[model samples]
Target: MKSRGLLSVLTFSEKRENLLFLLLNEPKTIAEIKGYLNVSTPEIFPRIKEMETKNLIYKENKYYALTPIGKVVAKFFQPLVNTLHVIEENEEFWKEHNIEAIPQCFLERIDELGNCRFIENRLEEMYEPHTEFFENISKSELVMGVAPVFNPAYPAFFLQLALHKVHVSLILTKNVFEKVKNEYRDDLQRFLECNNTSLYVLDDISLAFVVTDIFLSLSLFYKNGIFDAQRDLISFDESALKWGEELFNYYKEHSKEIKSL
Candidate 1:
């Protein structure tokens, strides 16, 4: 294939397409071509002359035939026509389902094409979606949040955090403290101790949040289960880290003296 360098030179119209198809069966004079298409000679002659001028066709005797470039152009455009035909064939079927979004795109493929898989979650599921409202926590130097103590998946995320060596201070509620004491406290405490991670016993605090120097990821729990409050994690870019630091500082100042659990 010759590279035309990102531009198309082909121009098309209904008349040209019809003439091209007719010529494909075998070349014929203008009179014969016009008669075959059920059109008068005057209507077909101008189109043939224009196609010849565009190098889409060439005249030999009184017959017109596709130029080499025109054949290549036709082949190149066939895929697009086939795709349109598919859409046309399914148009009624899609209309019946009331589906507004087309399924032709490859969003997940685009995301996974690079070295890492890019994951995205909905804003409604996050603790805060407003970029401006979370500005303070988005810039923190450190974060201390209360943990739910009962969530199974919470441990998985906590393990990931420990693996990453991200700094996050956790405060476990007394209700959580008692449960852990009765069951998983020893293992949980050992894990925390290994990381030199800080933990506070459940006191006045409400929920759990993991905070790093620049961002916060929060989770809360009620009788049902855990909900994300400070839902999305933010990065500690220079400016964002500065803002998050202020928020962390404010919380640190206001929080009651935290003792080791």
Candidate 2:
């Protein structure tokens, strides 16, 4: 019952939540709250009073500040709010994919993907590689990836990038590596020969993602274990790029480096 009441007060209104957020950073007087919230005294005072009654905040001199309990609540609310934003931003995409394929740590930090662009294939382009994705990655100087699926276009394009001195570090599923070793042996050999290239083979993985110097793109298997070639979640933000690097390393450490063949 106590927890229920606190949760209700914490989530009661956007204004209340905003007030808590404002106090999380610094103490503010009524005038400052009014200026930031753009609400009149009649509107702001009642919300402040409710928070005070809950002991979520306290007044010191002319300023309002979060109590220690309020600070702890503020800490709790941020990740919850950020997780909601990430799920809300791409509602359908998140709903249909196997989100569990993403490791827990990365999923918790989904907020890093705050600036993501969720691109679904057009009906006419349903089977084609995303032109914008290719164009954006074309300008990259370094690319790190984990792939569980293979496309016919990848071999030639990745080799072209490597030939032009772009650093390429990739981890491929055992099956995909076998397919490449047998079918595209020349291109695979040439790609591995580059001083700037590194390759690895790892199985028992279910997601494909790439992080480049310019952007990050993620692809995941359907809940039924099939890859969806139609949609891509891409982000150009530096934070997402950092997150992707960590994700790549997580799998890379579990993989076998292919110095050749």
Top of the candidates by lDDT: 2
lDDT of model 2 at position 188: 98
lDDT of 2 by residue, 15-53 (tens): 888999999999999999999999999998988999999
- Those runs of model 1 whose alpha carbons end farther than 4 Å from true positions after fitting are 1-145, 148-150, 163-166, 218-261
Q: All candidates' lDDT scores?
A: 0.49, 0.89
lDDT for position 15 in model 1: 64
Q: After superposition, how far is residue 1 of candidate 1 from its true place, in Å?
A: 71
Give me the displacement of residue 197 in model 2, in angstroms.
2.0
Q: State the displacement of the C-alpha of residue 241, model 2, in Å, after optimal TM-score superposition.
A: 2.8
Q: Root-mean-square deviation of each candidate, in angstroms?
A: 19.1, 2.6
lDDT of 1: 0.49
